[model samples]
Target chain A: MALTRDDVEKVSLLARLQLTDDELNSMTEHLSQIIQYVHQLDEINTDDVAPLAHTLDITNVLADDVVADCLSREAALQNAPQRDEECFRVPAVL
Target chain B: MSSPETQPMGGTPYAVVVGLEVHVQLKTNTKLFCRCPTTFGQPPNTQTCPVCLGLPGSLPVMNRHAFELSMKTALALNCTIPYFTKWDRKNYFYPDLPKGYQTSQFDLPMSEHGHLNIFSENDEFADKQIRILRAHLEEDAGKSMHDEAAGVADSRIDLNRTGTPLLEIVSEPDMRSAAEAKAYLQELRLILLYLGVSDCNMQEGSLRCDANVNLHIDTPAGTIATPIVEIKNMNSFRAVQRGIEFEVGRQYTLWQKDKQVLGDMPKQTRGWDEGAQVTRAQREKEESSDYRYFPCPDLVPVVVTDEEIQAMQQQIGTLPASLRKQLLDDHQLTAHTSAVIVNQGLGFADYFLALATAIDDSRLAGNWMQGEVLRILNEQEQTIQQFKLSAAELGELLKFIQSGDLDNSKAKDVFAVMIESGQSAADVMAELGIEKVDSSQLEELCQRLVDNNPKIVADVQSGNPKAVGALIGQARKENSNVDPGQVRQICLALIEKL
Candidate 1:
């Protein structure tokens, strides 16, 4: 189902969102309508049908076992909302 | 069900059921639905586009390369290529998934019913092949990186990897051991390389694995076990191994307590703590997540003809399995030795073959490679491509092994110079004064050994031929070039005369 204001608020809470009530209500309506449209596919018989995972048949893709350049400390930290000398700063996740 | 302490010993004939889901990024010049350059390690957020960032009006246009790589990966996995495949939006909300919905293959995935050939490196273990259920294409989420510098205050999102195209390959629950899992991942990585797909860097989160593990315990009614807990986002081989080990044991322990869950509850997602060797809980009650999957109205279904599949198959070249088998037979290596040779990327394997072609003794080239070359590269934590030694210099070194001038032992010293000075192997041998001693000189030295170890010589005189091995060892210490096998033959004859 598309996210409704209630659905949005529920998911936001599940996802630890601190949204305003207006944002929650708007998101719930938006989500419900989207879900309604997505549910239309349920009419088709898919029980016997295998779920599709890829669009192409190609397989065996590999990376060369070589090390290349990585972001410098400055580059990695450039866009951090907050940062220190070596890494990004974050609120206590614990 | 298995008992905790007694489980390891008296466990009944229980089957090991395993399923694997592999995520691989496609090699594209840009993000899957955006033109934000798909280069790794770019400045964070600098690579983000409005579409990748999920700006209100920005819509996703599929990257052709992403689809091509997905199809290529499916074909290589020996999957049944779908005649018609389409994309769906798996609606979910996570800060990492900026779009709040992942554009993935759901009901009409790209490929299905494929298998990868997985033969163990160890001859002691039985060889087995497992089937890959399917491999699908999807978009990757950005990273929710905690600040390294501001460790106490705030969290940030760097969308460098956002919208990166990924192939989600799910395998039938068939793997049995950590070694088998590692081998599977290794083979999979090479296939990507051969196809020239994604860079597949685990360090950069391009190639990441979440191992699903559970143990079945035998009971009179039937074998039963707890639901499989999935271990996720492991970045290294060792981590994969450790993660699997922990989950397998955890499942077995739950079974031992008669807590084997037959269906939904036991299966949950877990994350690995590499330092502690324990798999911590990430999410629970997650047998199959219901995103209420539906086809994305934005994208069209991708259809391919048989001709296109055949053409791609023909264009595809040698893979790791066949190449490994060829090398073992043609090069006369132990199966164990050849397995290690293949584990190193196909490029490294080809480099060895190229060097071997120029040398007189190909086996020696393999030996030197399996030994000194790997050692040096490992010591420095460098990849083969990063090795300062050129292939030509390695070729020269192999030549020295071929000639009578430098025996295998002396060749080690010769290798040092060649690696550093970039000199010819022969020249290094000469400069180091490691030329083989004359046969006549060796024979003369052998006589002295016959005289010195008289007791051993007496034993050989009495027709105990094994005693001559001791003399051969003494002679070899004095001269590295002296062939112990040849000296063993000679010392026996001389002792008979005595």
Candidate 2:
């Protein structure tokens, strides 16, 4: 299936991405090609095989509910682009 | 335009349809996927780590205890546990979410097809079974604090609550009114509390709810259904009822003007502005496809066994509904009295059981629990666990009344002193100068009253039984230790001999 300009635009909007007209056209072509390449798997016959959730042959990989060490407030906020004294600051959501 | 009628289409009847989605935080020590403590009211960012913060190289793992707690809750709610369950990544863009996607369950959930019965003894609402569609476990996002008072355009993010384990239970639209919705919430909260799975504290955000509401109007032009609106930000159960009521009215008014049907408009999202008591439209509801849910490859799927499910079922000891029934049947208590005890939570119910069993009189124990025990709990703002007098001790005090050593009023005086000094009932009675008059002494006193009040004795022999009231008052004035009831009985017997 070919991806249209509108599909690319909608995807970008959901991802909060901004694209110029030229970039949009290129992205539309690139995404369509990628979809076409992935669609080749539809040719395989796997009626008997069950769908795989994970590659590993394992299940129920869990940890006990125990508290360990946590990063200090200073260390946690060190990598924030903008921060107040104790919290990471972002643009107003509303 | 023609003037709209005061009522919708000349008083056409309508029924409100409501479905609720409740999120309860599991009482786990650590985060769902990490070792960070899930403590509330901590300093901002102090509990953050690479896993919860969604660092590039960090991998997520499930907490075994959290999963077990969720299963326990679902089982208590009568949900069926699926053998296989997998986690999915729900993609979204929000500042509060450190990860670009939230880890949730999509096609396969932990449990499904459960039902909870909501009823009130007073018949405030009809008894109905609220059907549960599904219950899934997910991670909670961080909190975003926007300071309007500071007049800042920036919002501060607190990651302390990030990655907390949350079990979201979705119910079908089975509620017909606001009162049923509130009852459903109360019953659900009570069950969660009984299972010890979640604190179910609304003030601390341990429990939160969102409601989807709409109306079905019966008009001359067939049934007109309104668009479903999802309401959020209801801090209390009362707010939930009021919000749904407001939404129903709002939808009816809008339908009167435009006659818009269900599919005429997309589903909307609204927030309950509690101060104004109005539901303000927040935004258009997002379609489920927009989230683009896909199975997460980072975590392996969980396969539960039959034995594990049975173990969880056993772990959930008597829930509130069954316990309420047990109290009514075993103790032969009135429906109102049984409901009062069970609704105080498991601790208070346990106290009542211990007291009733110790004294071997449920009626007496139930009365004391509903009257004195509950009154003390409310007056001092204390829980049953924090109560000064233990059930065993209270039972010992009530035994005095049972044995006719002390009357009800005198026993209350002893109970007061016992609570204050932590003394035994006998000790408190002695200290209060309330001596138990022996049967011989009581008989002698009655005989003297019988002889002195010959007129009263004649009146009683003539079938004027109430004439014994004055003699009993005289007996009490003579020996302050005598019980009024015992005095009356003895006086009647002595007068009968005449």
Candidate 3:
């Protein structure tokens, strides 16, 4: 029902977001308001009903295992911010 | 056996607790949620599609074959399949993960509560059951190649492996030592191979494993458990064993100084530096809550009927454990010998079965399989399927030895020639000019040798049985095709009559 600054910090860290102190405080309040707004659904007496896993009523939407044509290397790397000859380049992970 | 490395400084014994998380790439024609071919070693990022690349407005649909293969593997491991399972989005921050999340199963995994029995090669440990906690199907991430040598400090991403179907099998911390852990991995790999679900090729990254290792020490005060460290980057099973062993020792030494228990610190993630043979600390492991898993709204839940589960069970066929037992029971082979045959994989096992059935001699067939056949396979770097000699041909060749028509030495020569020339047993024998000496001809040859050697015959008749060895050698010199055992038997009888 409520969020803490520590929780916001942890979430930000996991999301790889760098936030300043003011941004962290504002985010803590904003996220808490969003959680409180969503918690309004708890007021409904839906305990008897099972939790819905998906919005749709259908199940087992599957496709057969068949290979289709993929994009060319140039097309795949076209949108990358930076790329090498055959791969998308990013900041070193290690 | 408790080694000194596993023992604490206070003369207290400790047990190494290792739980393995094996990730096997499902052998499917396409990616899990897309039609892009899941081929390895292709040009980087060439296999990308709208769905696998996580482009906006692209809906992801599950691959039917990938789920079925996962079910087949779960059944083979004796796991309980749930009737209903749903996918969840595991949010993470990694460059290789194009979607910024991995689609995996959360609380409701596909299968759970299974066990695999692992057998040790030696008396190091007894057969034990490694319990499976859960096995869930997930989409694999792409590969990140770091160019440290060029000092670029940039990493290249290969999205070819993105969206590939991977089954993550999590085993309980049931292993007590490094050896047991290795055995568990080996047995699991063999089963996966037998089911034809995954290639289980460690070199190709089709099969990968990360081990959670810790130590439970028996101190005078009470039992103290070290903080569990998850070791990754072990490319092979041997590396896994050595990594766990090294971790066990390192934890013991660390505990001796700090006396820290499991909760004193957060769980650590370490990488196995195989070159240095040490597990270096990488980072602290995040709790499951850090992943912020939530049900994915894009994909519908999968529901399996009882009939479908039964069909999958039937499709699994005979697993390695049952096949090993069958090898022991039907073939009357030793446990070690049966394990060897089964571990060579299903093709080699089938080859042995056909050959043994044809010859009606299990031990002889097992011996040949372990001795000559395996040797040739290793030397030629070929699988049993690639072998030149068919089981029927090998059986026919062994039948000569069984019927006393060919001696073991000559039979080996024929076997070699048959392999080289791709000829059948009869053809090879004929080509080598090796004719089975008829029983009467063999007897006549033995009689000539016995009569020619009067002193040898007198010694044999006077109770020196070994003196017949000289006459058998003479019979071999006379006719190289003569069976020495038959010659000895006929010569001894003739000398007794004289």
Candidate topping DockQ: 3
What range of 10 consecutive residues in model 1 chain B has the weakest lDDT sum? B1-10
Give one digit per residue, the lDDT tens place, for model 1 in B67-164: 77777778888898978778888876566666778888877788999998776555523566778988888889887765455434456666678888
Candidate 1 deviant stretches above 4 angstroms: A1-94, B1-13, B123-125, B147-154, B177-179, B193-196, B255-260, B264-267, B285-289, B380-382, B386-401, B433-492
As a TM-score, model 2 comes out at 0.93
CA lDDT, every model vs. true structure:
0.73, 0.90, 0.91
- DockQ of structure 3: 0.90
How many clashes in candidate 2? 0
Alpha-carbon lDDT of model 3: 0.91
Q: Once superposed on the true structure, which residue ranges of model 3 sit more than 4 Å away at CA?
A: B1-10, B454-468, B492-498
For candidate 2 chain B, the 10 contiguous residues with the lowest summed lDDT are B1-10
Candidate 1 colliding pairs, count: 58
* Tens-digit lDDT string for candidate 1 (A1-94): 3444665665676556798978777777777777888899989999899765454454233232322243454664565576556434445432
Ranking under TM-score, best-scoring first? 3, 2, 1
